[model samples]
Target chain A: MTKVALTPLAQSLPASVPFVGPEAQERAQGFPFKARLGANESTFGPSPKAIAAMQKAASEVWMYGDPESHDLRQALAAHHQIAPENIMIGEGIDTLLGVLVRLYVTAGDAVVTSAGAYPTFNYHVAGFGGTLHTVPYKNDHEDPDALIAKAREVGAKLIYIANPDNPMGTWHNAARMQQMIDAVPAGCLLVLDEAYIELAPEGTAPAINTSADNVIRMRTFSKAHGMAGARVGYAIGAPDIIQGFNKVRNHFGMSRISQAGALAALRDDGWLGHIREEVSKSRERIIQIAAENGLQTLPSATNFVAIDCGRNGDFASRVLANLITAGVFVRMPFVAPQNRCIRISCGTAAQMDIFAAALPGALQAAHDNLG
Target chain B: MTKVALTPLAQSLPASVPFVGPEAQERAQGFPFKARLGANESTFGPSPKAIAAMQKAASEVWMYGDPESHDLRQALAAHHQIAPENIMIGEGIDTLLGVLVRLYVTAGDAVVTSAGAYPTFNYHVAGFGGTLHTVPYKNDHEDPDALIAKAREVGAKLIYIANPDNPMGTWHNAARMQQMIDAVPAGCLLVLDEAYIELAPEGTAPAINTSADNVIRMRTFSKAHGMAGARVGYAIGAPDIIQGFNKVRNHFGMSRISQAGALAALRDDGWLGHIREEVSKSRERIIQIAAENGLQTLPSATNFVAIDCGRNGDFASRVLANLITAGVFVRMPFVAPQNRCIRISCGTAAQMDIFAAALPGALQAAHDNLG
Candidate 1:
């Protein structure tokens, strides 16, 4: 354009975009989906108390939130029974992941993640020029043992493993997860993403530890707490490692009303538990609906259930298109084999009813269109 | 410590931080400052209508926002009369600034700025491993010609200039600024931070350029539109360069409520015009108050006025301390010559009354303590 050039790194980076939004697809399709089950959002919505708190705080949008996010951090500390230094709040786990990667991984440094794990984390690694070594999923689950071995092999400075893993919604028990955690090489900091732990059964999450310097566990209000739109998430870790974020994070990046809403959300664990139950029922309904359509369903511990479509990724994609064209918005895995199953988020009884009603017709259409 | 070292770039970054927020100081001081004007927040707050929109969107918090932020960008395009492709929105101008710097700067690359310009910009340069070359402000104004020369001297990749500049609040006319813009070296990009532009006078801003590949003009609703807490800002540049942000930005970083408030704030230009009027009156009041206290006040097109404290940096620090002790919170420039002044934000008449009541006594106490 102007003959100005960007850095070599930036130039090398393809104007590659992260995940393309459902909205973009919807606009291209020229229609709105009757049911939105994509993006793994909590269709059940955030806690009523959080909604009320945001409503209450709506009028005070002029004042900046505490730069330290002091009150919210205090509330989180009390909720987690940890010291304030054990917590660091931010825009979301996605944003925090970027900061942590930037903190530890330099150009040419190695980092590890399960193949087909959260691409956002990978995007950050690529953004900072880190070398990423991805391990394949074992038996449809993220193999933490393989991840640690690869980390040691690669001499990775960081390794990311999401418990109750995305795409598949499969998980390891807390004891086994901790076993993997304990076996990680001393020099590689483990980033255990517990983003879906709240929806999983008890023992699906490892015990909290703020003194562990070699690991940082991330949680989000976006999932079980159901405030995805609010963009609030936190990382819990050793104080020094946690404080490392202060060196480079946009210090005043949080929204004031979000801090207020998160505080209210954390205090309403009763609501969290209730939504967890609803998600469990929704999962069951989704499984039943899949079986009714003669599709196999995976055992899931997360909010979304992956339905095996008895076909390859291309076939699953065609089915997904059929679903979208039928006014039901759902997504599927990106990699092979796993992409053979379409991932559908747990939705309200009515939204699921719409999906349940439409899936049969969509499947028939896909079958009819098959050449 | 686990001794899992940070990257060389991250390790090289200082443990330094941005402005110690007023809330942090208030906590240290054991009482909130009576007049909260240090950060240039709109005391009048965002429009009532905007708050209502955020409240309306509160329960929808469980849904992730449209990642494209299409509605806001479309509205912004219509409002600014530019193609939607020319605008890119992010968490805030601060976040966008970091991303923009990262886009062009690699390790050891040279970036130029005034010695005492925005510290956060400097923070990003250091964070990205860019070497910072500083040119001292000439006559309390950011010397664009000097910056251009430095760019040519060091083969600088990027330069920072804030029209209606921060700290000292001095500005160059649009014609002078355009001349300086024309002189930016062919390889370098100029970052024009207009964070406080809406409150600025008519001639203080440059005409919007849809084809400016060498410069990215930043504008935000943080100052006059009174959405500082909401954390929304956008950059206007050539389409190709604006889309370059796709490679690395946190695609879903913006909060939904924030989008609502910013959209509403943008829709209500009357509220912004009202804010400008109020800011002007407050500026006049600050000037009169400074004269009453026997100090010189500089002309300001932005929301804040820089008052010459009639002494050096040390004396001004003492005066600022006296004001803090007298229960009024104010800040000053951190570096020499400019630090010989105190910067106060435009607040309500009543807040200025509080400031006026405390200034003479604070000045006297500072003088008495000099012995």
Candidate 2:
């Protein structure tokens, strides 16, 4: 066999994906999961107006999407009350995060994040050859103070925090978040991943600071807007920081149908309000079921709940396995303590009922096998 | 303004986009272009089945796309008579090219291409800190012998050639392509961009050699399938080369709707046949219109034609500017000789009529302004 030369940095990396998508799991198991509650997706779906817009634009796929994503960016700027120069649109938060790392991270540079906050972010840092310095979660939430201190100590170029975070579904209020933003060191860039911010309570998302050169807040249509598959996300930052993305981003990456769909979705404030109400109700139901089953539930500002398995990581893994076997898809954190809980996304009542039915048997199966 | 720290390479790079999209032009002009023929897009549109599939998936955009793009890859694998492991799908050929460059080109690595080839590819190489070595085109076509010679001379890690080349729209037969592939330096990778392969003649595509580790072939649904906005593209290469993409690619970058739509488009051979016929007809019409205006066209294997305006680079640029002013969108090459020709994409008869009506005026305007 012939050997093609690869970059030394690329060769040193492992061929691993950040997360095994639920679809891959289904293919391996030879059947699909009955209730898709693991990925923190909005089962309520995108607004009908967005769907209509995308379907209408389907026939016009012959043309390339505007590389600038002009109209969509303009609309986003108006909605946020900022100049379009302060926003940069991309395929998704994941894609934007990858671009962000490329702009700031060089080999051997340091980056700080919660130990298990978002594996995808860490994956990007590692992919760019950045050395990761992790701070453990404090009270099941990302420790902003620790992350800031560690970044300063290591002379890290980047720090990542997900407001209304994933896995544990815990969040800090706006004032606390503002403090963290202010405490970000001089040379380090704070990446505020607010993918779930739309679902968080009032006073959760800090005021948009377009002039803040040290912070870039990323928001997406995937969570509360219910268009994860559409792959639309934007970053709000200082003009210079936003313009830097132009040097590295795939300019024509946006899907034309997605641009149309996201624009329509963003304009429909009523649809967003409705999704919030539906997600709130679903969260309450999740709390009720976990309480009824003698499990403790974490408070959530996002569209998912983490149910305490009341045991070690091993017990939780066994329970998750049984749940998968029972056709319910739920995920857990990768670290200790947090791994003792299973995270479930808010779904329709029917889907939740399926999870509700499967959990008891799954728990029993876990106990019977382990004990 | 506070200076956020960027990597040294990034700091040294200018904030620039490879191409300014047509929408930006429209925004500046304060009106839409009457004839959209600049980007070489398939004005014939996507398969009806593809449009339908995307329409159906519009409602399902709440869920994230299968990060693996599993079903589409499986379908592509079957179509090409190759294992799924030999294929890697991405947002578009542009994204795949970016990843390929990241894998092969580290800082200061030598990469070779024709002087006026795809600018987007060059943009990616520069973005990754690759030192590009250019060889000028021979007789308005990509010179395989010259490219191979330059690669050897520079100890190039990667060589790029677009078969049925863009900007010029000329191609080489499969046997010549095979010679080029066989001549690639031992450690260097040959990147064959066949984004227009479906529209090329039957003998144009070289036989697939998945075991050949030195070459990676890229294709897109953008042209003949008419789904440029959907951003679906794939690369066929050796398993190890394909696997290397996993180390750095955004695994979940694909839009779920695009995956579904592309799979449907690939399965509908009759639709592809129809598109090819339409594109062929449109190409003939474009040739006729150029001839009526007393211009000479280069032999074109792709959907677009390059018309030599019987003048130098300055005159061709003036003609293009006049065309834009007359509500027609067209493009021209960037180098000296190639810049004497203007590139125009095929469009429907009504759009062609508009272009036809405007071409005489544009030419007169160019002559009047220059004389």
Candidate 3:
């Protein structure tokens, strides 16, 4: 027997990760991927200004970043038009979710989310030993009403919904989101994940309301600002809930270089507009490529389009596997119906060209494997 | 009443930080610190190669860092002559400590540490609802026997000790540390924090033994590598405990630039040697400055010196306050006996010169402030 023992909750958790990175996949496949599109990372890259800022901050990394992340919080506050007291900066949205789950979910507490939403959230809930209740998506979009009903049934302490959702690229606009927020059950808090909001059209997000005690909005530089590797994300909520993060967070966890990069990225609106335009074009290209292959595509409000394989999850899994084998990295939903479609992230023209070239052969191989 | 409720454990935690950063102090003081000689950060800066690597990686921030931290972990493994599975890279040692605490100490579990030791560990213990039992320092050194006895008494799940210790800058040699490790109570893990080990004398750390399930050694780029802001730290331990981090860690939380920087920093041994020589000189200079001010300095094995203020915690607090007012940043221990000394981190010649220039007035001001 090992001399050291893990806590019961920790012992019960599986040593599985939410997502395996493309680098790990490449290592397994024993070759580099030709087109990197698996994770919903912005292939368009961060603002030049952000890159410059990170480079400048690189030499100044000997000192610990301001534990409070003061400057970045101030900048984020200005950008969001919320008081600095309403914001809490974290290493990433994943880290923030972990901390949030720790705050609200103790052992056996209930938490609710869409079945095929961000696995990282469910990972945290399970990590904390929270009993999770998942509602299935309604026509690929997260069914907010069903989620609320489940939360009410389970008496969940927290409810999670991601706008411009992952894996399917489906979204609900402000009115629908506000309605969900309004019906968040008396004692439950709504975790409104807006990680992909910047990629969606305007009116997709509700206005910032720091007065509402039951809702917190999570945002990230990983998508529109294109700094996923920098690991910067923030949450906006009521002052009390925001301040509660201070009780459990790794106070000095942020990277100083990332703070500077995020600050610079937030200041550059033109780069974001350019990225939106580029992503729109890439989405169009992905749709056109799917059309050429006689496949239908899900309408994407985010950086990725879901290509419908017009069959089942197993066929789409085969298509995804063949795509990865063909040196193009892409992902798909894990649940049924949605898993019938393989999700592809928007990439640069060259990457799209590579994906376009690989798809036809990959689809033919999947069909051939049907025998 | 707030609609959102924190878990009972989280609600019980106070919203206090372990350390108020120098940046926050500067903001409060309405000016910047002239000598950044606090927080135990190496003001000498990271290796030039590290800075260059980070700068080069700046644009690549669009892609998420490898969730497994493949390259960095492999390099760390080679550097330590351990298998890759023995290492777990984290955002920093602080984050790793939090995860480790979560793994071992559930609510109401016992954790042991030295009084006036690293408060961040205590902070994490409190955050996890662990009952921390601190043994008083024996002659300004961590009392390993006392810690072990207390762990036995309280049935602690974990014991934390920082060699080349923080706040006091004192340490135990490898043989002494190995003895302590041997004495760790059964079922308790020993968290040997070696954050300052890179600056200590040879033989300060015990040999790496990944088979030892009861001990985990944390190493960082923050001290001698001079990349505190980069947020790169790792643990060497039995593969089971090391792999256990995957159960609770933010897998994609590392900054890509930081991964590149730490990998480059680890490769540049000459830079590390140069830093050690410089830190030794700075330590001597700080001792001399303390003597010149009619104060005594503790024997130090790390990059900082703890100068005895010749009175008590209140006096040392006054001295630290005056130093900050005079534009030199410094810190003090939180608990008694050791708190009689003020801690000053090693800095460059220019920064040491600033501390030298500011010492007399700060001393006088501290004396004057004594009622």
Best by lDDT: 2
CAPRI verdict (incorrect, acceptable, medium, high) for model 1: medium
Alpha-carbon lDDT, every model: 0.88, 0.92, 0.92
Interface RMSD per candidate (angstroms): 1.8, 1.3, 1.3
Task: Write down the TM-score of every candidate.
Answer: 0.98, 0.99, 0.99
Where is model 2 more than 4 Å wrong at Cα? none
- The residue-level lDDT of candidate 2 at A189 comes to 90
Q: Superposing every Cα of model 3 onto the true structure, what RMSD results?
A: 1.1
TM-score of chain B of 1: 0.98
True contacts kept of 2: 0.85
> Candidate 3, overall lDDT?
0.92
Please write out the lDDT profile of model 3 over residues B38-153, one tens digit for every residue: 88898889999999999999999999998898999999999999999999999889989999999988888999999889989999989888999989999899988999999999
Residue A102 accuracy (lDDT) in model 2: 97
**Full-model lDDT, candidate 2:** 0.92
Candidates in descending DockQ order: 3, 2, 1
Ranking by lDDT: 2, 3, 1
Give candidate 1's iRMS in Å, 1 decimal.
1.8
